[model samples]
Target: MAAYYSQNNPDPSPTSLTFAYPQTMDWNRELLRNEPGMLAEEKLSDVERLKVKIRMFARFIGMKGAETPRWEYERGVEILARRIERRVRLEEETEMRRKVFMGPRAWQA
Candidate 1:
């Protein structure tokens, strides 16, 4: 193991860690925020969070194991539509706030 620490040709200069595709810090931060890595901040157990999430998501798509009826499927679709509408409204509100903060659009109120 003499080669391990024998000055090793100027320490081989720590093979440059590089990304194939370029991405900004904001995009990377956004991605990490949605990732499971954020679970460390949780006061509750991850098990509880995961179980809750599973129940919540299962309620949405009607989980495969849960013998769902036709009406249940229809209702699930309606619920999803409502959720999307709410998300759209929130996003629109954020966009309006950003526009107002930036103060560029003459038409914005």
Candidate 2:
């Protein structure tokens, strides 16, 4: 674990390490791969939230132009959202069919 400073330091360094924004699409893809169960809206919300954090980090590092366009960010999110919606619909349909086929038997222990 890393310890954090309680307050801002009085002295600032002219030479500090900074990193540029890596490809956000790569980040989006990796996030999706890691969280297969995330709902579509949750994924989109997470992406937006992460974008804000990335922007703040860029500013803290004294860098400019780290923000990607809104459309670029939404493109990947929308694609995943569609897939999630389709999956949910399919699951609901499957459950409905199972209930219908099982009828009264489904209620038995």
Candidate 3:
């Protein structure tokens, strides 16, 4: 079977590759408009907003457990919220820095 297959397929080179280009060149504009990290809290979809709320709720419940007090659970949620806000701010700052260093032309094909 090996001998027969090799004899029938003499060429070992790979098939040609095809590249598909976008129909429009408004990708940069689209990217800026749709960037999730840069979006305001109000601009986020209902599901995304709900997910953030659910995360805080879940963290609060986890910290509550069986013997934890209400104040402790509330404090835990507040701490978690602060940490999440800090992370989002940091990401936004990083993205701004990247744009400043790389310039607008960096995203071009």
Provide TM-scores for the models: 0.33, 0.38, 0.33
- The worst-scoring run of ten residues by lDDT in candidate 1 lies at 23-32
- Encode model 1's per-residue lDDT on 1-109: one tens digit a residue: 2344343335645333322222232423221233454333322244533444455456555567544445435544554565567779989999998677555564574
What does candidate 2's lDDT look like per residue over 1-109, in tens digits?
A: 0112312344454223222223243443533443767555545456665765676568656698866667646755676677778899999999998768556667784
CA lDDT for candidate 1: 0.46
Candidate 3 lDDT by residue in tens digits, 7-42: 334567522321122124332332113355653432
In the order shown, the candidates' Cα RMSDs to the true structure are 14.2, 10.0, 20.1
Q: Can you give the lDDT of residue 59 in candidate 3?
A: 55
- Score each candidate by Cα lDDT: 0.46, 0.57, 0.48
In model 3, what is the error at residue 15, expressed in angstroms?
Answer: 63
C-alpha positional error of residue 10 in candidate 2 after TM-score superposition, expressed in Å: 11
Clashing pairs in 2: none
